[model samples]
Target: MKGFSAFLGKEVKEQLRNYKFLILGIVFAIVGLLSPLSSKFLPVLLESLVDDNITILLEDPTYIDSWIQFFSNTNQISIIVLLLLFSPILSKEYEKGSLVHMVTKGLSRQSIVLAKGTLLFFCWTVAYWMSGLITWGYTHYYFSDSTAEGLFLPLFSLYSFGLLLLAVLLLGAVLFNSAFVPLLTVGGFVIVSFLADIVPVIHEWNPLQLATRNTEILVLQEGDRLLAQAMGVSYFICIGLVILSIVIFRRKNIA
Candidate 1:
């Protein structure tokens, strides 16, 4: 526990020094602010773009629309930024020979992986929640009837999916020594997951649904069962990936 705490502290300090936290915070806050602002003004903006003679039939923006924008922005843009930021988790250390020194100094490989994963997860949670809170506040102010059923379940499911992605990236880092390799690994996984979604039988259990179907859950209270299943699968997959990373890192020959 002591070793894990020490390494976790080191990871946090490193992230702070690199300005990762600052970048993520700014990006997510902007996303939060934009979600509601765009939903509210998009109709007017579109109308302005058109000539006065043209009639643009658009529905009034609601809190649901704001939430849709929020999830879409977070699922696509925020997640990409997060993946890019942390893609080099283990590879950078390998390149710099930092892990070699730590291993030689009596740090266990499992502790290293666990600490880094925990720190990254913590940062992701904080950034995500900050954005969520901002979005909620703006959404309420804009639309007084902004209540959505089963909101927390969908949000948490999306968060779990993020953790699953991070774990997979970590495993990829352990398997390959290049910074780009882990990113490619994650990309390939996403592609395969998308392809898998084409099959009807797989929809209920697909982890990707956690990212894609959040709006449905928020709007209709639909997919509650699917959300639960996807969350379960995602968390288990995250744990499995972390364990696999530890096993592989232990056997890896560090030069």
Candidate 2:
């Protein structure tokens, strides 16, 4: 426990020194700010671009529109940024030959993987909630009459999906040496999951649905059971990946 805590502290400092926190903070904050602002002004912006002779009718943007922007931005750009930021996590340690010294100094390989995962998960949680809170606050202010329903389930599902992605990245890092390998692994998994979504038999239980269908879950009450199933599957997969990462890292030759 002490070793794990020490390594976790080191991971946190490394993230701060490397400006990971700064970059993620800025990106997610921008996403939060843009979601509500775009939803509120997009129609007006489009209307102004039209010639006086042309008439364009757009429905009044609502809180749902703000959430749509939120989900779209987080599901796409935010996840990409997260992947790029952390892709080199283990690879860089390998390249620098740092893990060898750390292990020799009495740190366990399991501790290293666990510490990295813990810190990354904490950072993601903070950034994700910051973005969501900003969106929530702005959405409420702009759409005062809007009432939020079924909010917690979708938010929880999205957060779980993010954790699952991080776990997969960790497993990829352990299984492959190159930084790009992990990125490709994670990307390929996502692509395959998306393609699998087209199959009716797998659609309801798909992990990708946790991310792609977040807005639907928030708005519709009918899909509650399916969303619960997806969330459960995602969390289970995340745990499995973390365990696999530990097992693979144990057998991996760092020297």
Candidate 3:
């Protein structure tokens, strides 16, 4: 137990030392500030492009617009940032023989895997929630009278989706020795999800619903079933992937 804590502390320190925290903070903060700002201002920006003779019919934007921006920006940029930031988690250490040094010093394999996973998961949660909460605060502030329902549902769904991705990436990191392997693994999942969506029968069951239907959830109540299904499937897969990581890491040859 003590060894776990000590290794966890080392992982946190190494993450901070590598500036992952700074990158996470900056990226999420940008998304937070910009999501609402873009939602409110984009119409005006688009309107300004019109000539005097042309009139564009613009429906008054609602709170749903803000959330649309939030989920869109998150699903697109946030996932990419997370993949890039964590891509090196295992590969970097393997490249530099960092784990080999610690393992030689009597560090347990389980402790090392747990510590890295803990720190990575914490960073993902903090960055994601900070962006989300900030966007929520600004959305309400900027559009006080506008209402978008099911705000919490999409937020939780997005956060959980991130956790699922993190779990998959961890498994890829443990199973393969290259940083690019996790990126490819995540990309493959994304492609598969896209394909799943095209089949009408599987579309509603897709975990991609968490990120894709966020705005719809705000406007309509019907998507809640899809959200729940996504949450369940994603959580199940995430846990399975984490367990797989642990099992694979235990058997890995670090030499």
Candidate 4:
């Protein structure tokens, strides 16, 4: 327990010293502010660009539009930022051969991987949800008629999906020596999940559904059984990936 605590502390310090948290907070803050601001003012921005003689018909924006921008930005750009920021986590240690010192000093590889993953997960969850909360608060303030039902389910599901991504990154970082390995692994998984979306049977089981089908869950009058099922599967996959990463790292020849 002492070793694990030290490792966790070291991971947190590295994140702070390297400015990972600062970068994540800045990116998420921008996304949070932009989503709602865009929802409220996009029509005016579009109108300003129109030809003088032409008038474009535009409906008043709703809270849903704010959420639409929120999910779109978060699921696309915010997540990509997370992946890129964390891709080097393990790769950098391996590349510099700094992990050798830790491994030889009796710092278990399992603890290192677990500590890093836990720290990253904690940081990502805070940033991700802080962005969403700010957007929600602003959207609600601007749009009085909007009420999001079953909001917790979707938000929790999205958070879980992010953890699953981090787990896969740990596995990829362990399996390959290059810094590009994590990015390539994540991208390939995304592509495979995209393909899975088209398959009728696999759609419900795929983790991709957690991100993509969120709007559907939000819009529908009732919750989705498949969302719940996918959440369960994703949670299990995250645990499995973390364990696999530990096993892989245990056997890796660091010398």
**Candidate 4: stretches off by over 4 Å:** none
| Cα RMSD for predicted model 1 | 1.3
Q: Which residue runs of candidate 1 sit more than 4 Å off their true CA positions?
A: none
Candidate 1 structure quality by residue, lDDT tens digits, 70-134 = 89999889888988998888887888898889988888988998997887788789989889889
Provide TM-scores for the models.
0.96, 0.96, 0.93, 0.95
In terms of lDDT, model 1 sits at: 0.87
Ranking by TM-score: 2, 1, 4, 3
**Error of model 3, residue 36, in angstroms:** 0.9
Q: List the candidates ranked by lDDT, beginning with the highest.
A: 2, 1, 4, 3
Model 4 scores a C-alpha lDDT of: 0.85
lDDT of 2: 0.87
* lDDT of candidates 1 onward, in order: 0.87, 0.87, 0.83, 0.85
Model 3 alpha-carbon drift over 4 Å, by segment:
147-149, 221-223
lDDT of 2 at 7: 88
Model 4 Cα lDDT, one tens digit per residue, 134-248: 9888988888977867676667767788888888888898898888788899888878889878987788787777888767777774556787778888999999999998998
lDDT of 3 by residue, 1-255 (tens): 777899888778887898888988999999998998998888899899889799998887767788888888988898789889888788978888888888888888888778778877898888988998888888888897655455777678778888888888888889889989988998898899898899987886778887777667767644556678888888998888888788889899977
* Residue 25 accuracy (lDDT) in model 3: 93
Candidate achieving higher TM-score, 3 or 4: 4
